[model samples]
Target: MPNSTKRGRRILAAGARTIGRGIVRTVTRSDAGAHWARVGGDWYETLGELKGAAMKLGQLASQYHDVLPPELSKQLARLQADAAPLPWERIREVLDGQWSAHQWQLIAEIEHAPLASASIGQVHVATLRDGRKVAVKVRYPGVAAAMDADINNLGRMLRMAGILPFDGDSLKAVLEEVRERMAEEMDYQREREHL
Candidate 1:
C-alpha cells in the first residue's frame, strides 16, 4: 500500500452537539424503545459514513446487550454487517500501487461493489486467473495515517455530546485502547501473518 493522499478527520462540534441532543431527547421520551431504535439507526448511518475510529467504536459498543438498550443495540449491530460501502472509485487507483503489473495480471476480475464494509476497510469479491474466487480487503485511502486524529477528535466529540458517559481520564483510557486496536488493524502484514 502506498502512502495516503487523503487528510485526517476533524469532528465538528455543532454536529456532535446535535447528535447529543437527540440522544438526550430519546432518553427522556415516553416512547423510549422507539426513540432508541431511531437513535441507533442514526448512529449506525453516521458512524458508517465517517469510516474510522467513530465507526469502530460504534461497532464495539453495539455488542453490549447488557449495557445498551436492546432496541439501540439491535440497530447498532448493523454496523458489523451492513455499514455503507465505499464506492469502487475511492480505492481503484490505489490497486496499482498495491501490486506489480505481473501480479495484477493474475486477477481475472474484481467486482466494483464491495461485499462488506467497516471502519477501516471494505471487502470485494474477486476472481483470480485460475478461476478461483477470492475476497479482497482494501483499506480506506487515509485511515491508517488518520487513525490517531480520528480517535482524538471522536473522543472529544463524544465527550462533548455526552454520548459516552465517561470523565476525561476514563474516556482517554478507552480511546487509547481503541488506538492500539486500530493500530494493529492497520498493519495488514501482521494480520496476514496471524492468519
Candidate 2:
C-alpha cells in the first residue's frame, strides 16, 4: 500500500478510537460504577492525542465545575496539563518560516527544544541580539487550516455526548466564542503588541 494510504488509515483508526472512548465516557455516570475512572483515563489519552481545538475545548469545559459533574470536570481538567508536543521538525518549520536569516542573526541563541507547549503554539527560550532573554511562541503550521474542522468535529461530539446544549443558537454562540479566541491567540503580531 502507498504511504499516504497507510497514513490515512491510521488517522481514521485513531479518530474512531477517540469517538468510541467519548461515547463510553458520556454514558458512564459516576454513580454507575468504577468504570468512570477508566473513562477518565481514556478521555485524557484521547484529548492528549488530539492536541488542537479538541484539547482546547476539553480544557475549557474542565473549568466549568459548577456546571459539570465534579468527576467529569476532574477528568477533563487533565487535558489542561497534558498534550502531545509537536515534533521538532514541525517546530523548526514554523521558526524557519517566521524568521529570515537576517532576523535569526539577531538572536543570540534559540533553544531547539520547547520551553512550553499548548494547543495552538509552543514557546521557546531565546536570547536576542540585545542579550535579553525572551520567550518566543511559534504557532504550529496548518493549525489555522485545521482549526475550523477540528472545532466543528468537537462541537458535534460534545452535542452528541450531551455535554453541550442541543439548542442551535447556544451552540453557535459557544462555537463562535471559541473560534474568536483561537483566532486572536494565533495572531502573533496582536499578542506581541499586547505584551
Candidate 3:
C-alpha cells in the first residue's frame, strides 16, 4: 500500500479506538438483509480525553458535517465546551500556591466551586477586598505534566504506527514546537506576566 493509504488507515484506527474506549454508545442499524454498527457518544468528553492532536482531529471532523453521520457530528459539536469542573479543594490548592493566606483573605469572597472548567483550567468568580469582582483562572492539576506525557506518547505512537513520515528534520521541527509551547505553558509566573 502507499504511504498515504497506510497513514490514513492508522489515523482511522486510532480514532476508532479512541472513540470506542471513551464516552460513547454503540448504535446498530439494520436493513432488510444487512446490519451495520454505528457509534455515538459525548463527543466533548471523548475529544477531551484524546487531547492534543486527537482533539484537533475531532474539531476538524466537526467542520465536515456533511461527510460525517449526524450522530458523530452532534457529538463532536458538543465537544466545543464539554468538561467537568474541578473540585473546590483543587481550586483552593492552586490559589494557595499563587496567593498568600493574607492575600486570600483579602479576597472578600471566592466561589468554592468553579464557574467553568476546561481541559487546561477552571475559572472562579471572586470578590476582592475592595469589593471588586474578578474572575480567577486556575490551571488544572498536573495538566502540564499530563500534556508533556501525552505529546511524547503521541509522537512515539505516530512513529510506530507509520503515521508520521520518517523525516528527521521534520520530527526535530515538531519536537521544537512542542518544547517551546510546553515551556511557556509550564510557567505560571510567565502566564501571570503575559496576562
Candidate 4:
C-alpha cells in the first residue's frame, strides 16, 4: 500500500511537471502549444486529471486571467469544467453507495459523461422519474488525501528551491485555510443545499 501511494505521487508529480512545461511552452509560442495538454481531445480533461490543488490553482488562474499575460490568459481561460467522465460502472458503484438501487433507477438519464468536472467532484445532467431536470454532482473518492499530499509536496519543493516568499509557519497557515475551503467544496450535499 505504501509503495502504491508513493508510485501514485510520483506519477502525479510527473503530470504536474508536464503541465508546467506546457504552460511555459504556451507562453513562448501562442499557437504552437495550444493543444499541449489535452485529454479526450479537450484541454479541460487534462486539468481534471490533476484532480487536486493543481486544478483549483488552474481555476483561480482562469478567473483572474485579465491580470495575466495574453498568452497565459488564453491558455487558462480554456480551463473549462468538461472533463473525461469516469466509466458508467464506477458511477453506478458511487450511486449505489449514495442511494438505494431503486432510487438510482429513478434517475431517468444520468449522462454517462460528466458535464463538468472540478477539483473535488464532477457534475452530470440527469432527469428524475418525476420529470425534473437536475444536476447531479458526485465527489471523487480519496480526493482530499490526494490534494493534501500534493499541496504539501509542492510547498516543500518550492521552499527547497527558494521560491516561497513566506516562512514555513505562515505558509502552513495559508495552506490550512486553503484546505478548509477545499473541504467545503467537496461536500456535495452542503453545496446542493446552499444552492
Among the numbered candidates, top lDDT falls to 1
lDDT of 1 by residue, 1-195 (tens): 122222222344334544765767767765777767876777776667677666787787776667677887887788887767777877786686787999789999999988887788888999999999998888887677767776776676667666555688987888999989998887888888898
| Tens-place lDDT digits, model 2, residues 55-82 | 6767887787787656667887888886
Query: Could you tell me which 10 consecutive residues in candidate 3 have the lowest summed lDDT?
Result: 31-40
**Full candidate order by TM-score, most accurate first:** 2, 1, 4, 3
Candidate ranking (lDDT, best to worst): 1, 2, 4, 3
What is candidate 3's CA lDDT for residue 12? 50
Model 4, 46-80: lDDT tens digits are 44565566456445545544544444445555555
- Ten consecutive residues with minimal summed lDDT in candidate 1? 1-10
* TM-score per model over all chains: 0.77, 0.77, 0.57, 0.63
Worst ten-residue run, lDDT, model 2? 1-10
Per-residue lDDT for 167 in model 1? 80
* TM-score, cand. 3 vs. native: 0.57
Candidate 3 per-residue lDDT over residues 1-195, each given as its tens digit? 113333334445554554443323224333311111133353355446544433443454455467555556666665556656667886787778878878878888888878886545767999999989998877765565455445554455435533234466665567556656656655767888988
**Which should have the higher lDDT, number 1 or number 2?**
1
TM-score of 1: 0.77
